[model samples]
Target: MFSSDIKIHIHGTSFTIHTPSGKINISLPFLGYQNISNVLAATALSFSLKIPLKKIKNGLLATPILSGRLELIELKPHKILINDTYNSNVSSMISAIQVLDKMPGYKILVSGDMSELGKKSVLYHKIIGNTVNLYKIDEILTIGQISYEISKISNNGKHFLDHRQLNKYLKKIFFNKNKITILIKGSRNTRMEKVVEYLIKESKKHVNFVV
Candidate 1:
């Protein structure tokens, strides 16, 4: 069971997880509606396995952050990089965009074509475009063939044929001393991490990146 009232904050999310014995407040380090779904699934599994509430709480808090999965990387000065480049699909892409909508500062979305989408690739990309158009994203940069469709529909979107050109453009953006939050995501084959690497290298701040 779960409580109806759930509160979200910049620090974390607070929700009630009800079990056979009682209910406990669970807090997660990450944001987004998808993460809440994940927590619910985990809670159901833990209840089925008869795990103690205390252990469940501890495990939830101790969950190791994954690479390229909504990982927050703080750059020098005042900029944030959201690295969710592990992989992408229609569902995940929409979720990422929704998360960006809630974030403060100038929000920029850097996305690549989603792979393994089969025959519906164009359709899915179009859907993503429409979703982005509906959001408050300040800028959108897309890569790959299908992703071009996203840029076509966005108000301030640009499509890059390859990473090199995108990197060149990003170099200029990073030089600006504005507080910006960038969300980078794409399919696994897109190697979106390279873009993040370039940004860090350009910073020249000697900061260690998690990816």
Candidate 2:
């Protein structure tokens, strides 16, 4: 049986996993509450498999960073990117916004349309916009047709009909800013990874590149 006294504590970019054996300190190379929840689920699964506590700790510590899935990229002079381009749903988007609210610095959210939501797409998108408005995010950039719904409810949001326009605008904005955290997310069909790639490439040439 798993330990009944398990406790989890999140402090900034790191979190502590307390188990019966010992405590494991983990620093995720990603952002968002979903990523932390994924780590917790993995820890529980390892315990159920009878993996040694030490090995579990080491494994979690050594977990490789994944691309376009809550991946964290840092640029010199204090610019951070949260790339969660793997996919999106109403639930995940809300969780991402909540994570952004807790983070320090100037928070910017770049969101693309969430596909596969079918008949509920409009309603869900508006819901996301309303939730984002309640967060501490400084700016919201939305792309695609359905995503415009998010901008409607946001206090400081701009909607772009195409990726080209969005990319151009972002380049100008990112180049002039420092000490900012940007969260990028969308569905697979939305090809949101392009936004992440654009920012990374631009950062190298314009900003003091870090990682």
Candidate 3:
């Protein structure tokens, strides 16, 4: 999908198409080469027939982001929040921290355990903690069993056994409006978003609820 009229060369095949959006080259998996070729031929036919851009965009927009990927929930003048807690692995954890480092504002990491990696579980948790510390995060609150290990390795973060303890502390001790950016990331099983609920409780009062 080239934004301008340009030739697209794929494998040994080459053709030109007019696309208003940026050029996109899709490499189909090699399981069924004939099927992929057939689809590509059909798509080319559509282009030859001058298909409407609205129809193409509608088809593209039907697809959604993959589950357990970075999902942005809010962006405010004082804060930004991401629901990247859908899943966690070493790669995903590092990516989240990198995003925090590049963004301007105090970063709050709300992390939990990354389960089912078996033997590497402890090492993975420690890596997440190490990643958090390597960044200039203002504060960190960890949840879940493995996340407790993350807190142990953290230099300036706290660990919570449950949201109950976290809520109490946030409401009583560390409550601040628009003063920080929050990253709520963890495994889905940990239900870390309960902490986000606590933030909303305070946010309804017009406090800056930056993500």
| TM-score of candidate 3 versus the correct structure, residues matched by position | 0.62
Task: Check candidate 3 and list the clashing pairs.
Answer: 1-23, 79-210, 79-211, 80-211, 81-211, 85-186, 182-211
Query: In what order do the candidates fall by TM-score, top score first?
Result: 2, 1, 3
For model 1, the stretches where C-alpha displacement exceeds 4 angstroms are 3-29, 37-60, 205-211
Supply the global lDDT for candidate 3. 0.61
TM-score of 2: 0.86
In angstroms, how far off is 176's CA in candidate 1? 0.7
lDDT of each: 0.81, 0.83, 0.61
Q: TM-score each candidate.
A: 0.77, 0.86, 0.62
The segments of candidate 3 whose C-alpha lies over 4 angstroms from its true place after superposition are 1-68, 171-177, 205-211
Top model number, lDDT: 2
Residue 157, candidate 1: alpha-carbon lDDT: 94
Residue runs of model 2 more than 4 Å from their true location after superposition: 44-53, 207-211
Better of 2 and 3 by TM-score: 2
lDDT of 3 by residue, 76-180 (tens): 355545556667777777877776665555567778788787998998888777778888887778878778877888777898877888876665433454445
| Model 3 worst lDDT window (10 residues) | 27-36
